[model samples]
Target: MNNEAIDIILAEDEPALGMIVKESLETRGFKVRLCNDGAKAYKAFEESQPHALVLDVMMPELDGFSLAKKIRLENEQIPIIFLTAKSQTEDVLEGFDVGGNDYLKKPFSMEELIVRIKNLLNRQEVQKTAAIYAIGDYSFNFPKQRLTYKDDEEVKLTHRESHLLYHLLQKKNKVLDRSFVLKKLWGNDDFFSGRSMDVFVTRLRKKLAKDDRIEIINVRGYGYKLMVP
Candidate 1:
């Protein structure tokens, strides 16, 4: 199956602009869901689990940063792209700090956004096939699909879940790209696979939750990081 159809959740307050971006991406063979507010974007994210998120910096109810933070808490490995009129360095830095993977200023070209998204997604795919990875307080067995902690019980993982975990584990403290994972594992980075990946991530998180020393940090626009402390 073709995995080229990467899904994206676009949160833009401007109606005309949102439509343009969504239509442009769809024309480029991407599946995009356009949202008007930060709150709705978050809801769509929870339900759709799009490969990547295009978030507007300012909005009513939640704003991009807050939504990103919330999304991070839920899933650490979803790619997020920020769209904003603010070009200040501090704002950009703050966005990065909040886990944004990429930022596009207002009046940005669709081509440019697409390029950045593709680049980020490509990086995510490379990490998935990594054979060796350290996750949290455990060593991730990629081929075996298991994470062995310092305890007697080792959790065995399913094929897709293991592949996803391996991808995140390889990233270590860095963000793993969302589209990269969906394309590599499910052969598509579309809406459905994105949702599936979320479920898998949830399972992985539950298994790893036993260790308080490790954290799976979610970078809003890029992906998740398996932080081993």
Candidate 2:
């Protein structure tokens, strides 16, 4: 809702349907770019890096799931909403499993789509808090999206990784409740998101492994504690 001309990449093969959705969003002050195939959509996404992505499940060259995986490697926090005709319990679960924020069945109302986009964007704004956090021998800057290793090497962290690190460091020396972390960082404690969080913790462990004095201790069924000696 800032009316700041949100950029979106619409990947739908049906020419007429694609135009309708594109125009509808554009009418509401969004900047929409349409791609007829998944390959082109990926290329467009790489070039534009839109605020949110609307992808069709079935497409040429590559499917929506494939395109999403590639996008997640480079950009982690950007909103991804799957717009597809495949409406099954498993399908929805699969979409979220692959890092999607939301999944919409085809024939969805424009109003519903708009609401989901707004929700995703608003959640993103909330998640963007303090950029720089002090960890052992490293400064984690979430906004710049970089991790400085104190002249050793500057490594970049994915958005989720950076945010997860910040949350843990903020609670340094105290036990960070796992459920609290899952809800705060990912906005959900669902199975897929929980697994995704585990992956992030593993990556963070590698990043912080250089410092012997710093440790991330799993508190059994509770959560984690970041300790500095």
Per-model TM-score versus the true fold: 0.58, 0.66
What is the lDDT, from 0 to 100, of the residue 67 in candidate 2?
90
Best by TM-score: 2
Per-residue lDDT for 1-229 in model 2, tens only? 5645678899999999999999999888889999999999999988886889999989999899889988888887888988998866567656765767777777889888887788778868866765576677887777655788776688876545666777788789999999998876555687766666676677788888888788888898888888975
| TM-score: model 2 vs. ground truth | 0.66
Candidate 1 C-alpha lDDT tens digits along 75-146: 655667889998765676567557676667788899988877886577456545556556656777665557
Q: Which pairs of residues clash in candidate 2, taking residues 3 or more apart in a chain or in different chains?
A: none
Residue 162 displacement (Å), model 1:
20
**Each candidate: how many clashes?**
9, 0
What CA RMSD would you report for each candidate?
11.4, 5.0
Worst 10 contiguous positions by lDDT, candidate 1: 123-132
